[model samples]
Target: MCVMSRRGRFQRGEGRHLCNLSGPPSGGSASPGSFLPLRGIDLKKGGRVKKPGRKALVSKDPYLRLLVKTYKTLARRTSSAFNRTVLKRLLMPRRFKAPISLSKLIKHMKGRENTTAVVVGTVTGTLLYRDMMMYVSTESRRSSDSAGEDDLRVNEVPKLSVCALRITRTAQARLLKAGGEVLTFDELVARSPTGSKCTLLRGATKAREAEKHFGKAPGTPGSSTKPYVRSKGRKFEKARGRRKSCGFKV
Candidate 1:
């Protein structure tokens, strides 16, 4: 029977054998140096081997699965890097396919006119309410009521063509109002198989709230990482390393 040595190397009964919980094989005793190989692993290699890239989609959504299937075919048939990238992104989980706002998309597409903007994720409509209010207040302060209204109209979204996995209702309404075109992956494939004149965009991956506490520990000198705390009040995570009065501050 095979055994493991102190250093974790497999041995031919040189070390303590595994308990004979089920006794030997039904036919006869196991050979002295024999070892059962693990499925999908090579004992000679000492570890499991796997192919790179996702083998299959993990999501059960029918629409998402269909999109992946289409992209997979495109990636295999076409030599376009865009198709390959889209296929890879399609296979990713929801978190990695971050949601982007329309404002950010307009900003990125500023100088690239008459090209399709492609995103392998959802497109959100507007900024948060607080930000929207702030924007309106600032615009109102800049000019008279009539002039401000005209300025707002002039700053309208340009005619654009966008393709994404999903789009929020407000975003779609805004796009349609501006005479822009919203497209799906299949439609985009039919239009431009090689992805010519298409610009790829993605949301900020580190913009998630959970990412705020991922860097250096909170209270560490020169570290801006946020601490996971229940509250910001005086009683919660505000003493010791957080304040100079309670022991030395970091």
Candidate 2:
């Protein structure tokens, strides 16, 4: 029931016209009255498809660049042995506390810088310590007793702990004031060689608390510095007096 005529074509007593949605198709339909889909949608694919290109990383972000710079600076200034021994210990599982207080850890580490204090020390050859809570532990003093007499030897453990650092509002302003930006959690955590987002963040919090007179509030969701946010029942808030703000150096 279809054929071309003076007024386009007729199909089932309905007048329909041919159309080209794209410029690619070659053959023309016989009826010219196919009306269901309006035609020509498939014709534009080849020519209109976008060519792939290289994706630019977010390295351009000032905060990201600063994170990288800070990492290099600290790594260069700090000892590999110290960083490796202390940072790795802190990063260990079940060794750190969540929502950790920064100022306290820094003060404690600096205060006990000379002593082999284990913020993350354990009796099982692991370390665990919390400055804010005045907590410290280490491999239980290795003790040896000579059966021959009342002679005893005490093996003192090495004070192999990180020196905590604290960054106050003035410090933050100074860092950011000079065209710098605060690090979001991810970036700060990334500073660690392990790429552990959480451990490094907690370590940073502990480190920053080392400085004297250092003070700032915690972080909240929607904060510019709040880096990690998972959708589907998880979201990070960026607000004042929140942990994410002051703990980790961004």
For every candidate in turn, the CA RMSD to the true structure comes to: 7.0, 20.0
Candidate 1 segments exceeding 4 Å error: 1-53, 127-154
TM-scores vs. true structure, each candidate: 0.72, 0.18
How close to the true structure is residue 192 of candidate 1, measured as C-alpha lDDT? 93
Report lDDT (CA) for all predictions.
0.79, 0.36
Q: Give the TM-score of candidate 2.
A: 0.18
Question: Per-residue lDDT of 1-250 in model 1, one digit per residue for the tens?
Answer: 3445568776554223353223457888777544544223124544456677786899999998998898788889988899889889889887889989988898899988699999999999874243344345565546756553433422467778999989999889878888999999889989998899999999988889999989988887889998988889868987788778989788
lDDT, model 1, position 75 = 83
lDDT of 2 at 226: 22
Best TM-score goes to which candidate?
1
lDDT of 2 by residue, 197-249 (tens): 22222433343223322344224333433233454242344333444464543
List residue ranges in candidate 2 displaced over 4 A.
Answer: 1-24, 30-102, 106-192, 195-198, 202-250
Q: CA lDDT of 228 in candidate 2?
A: 34
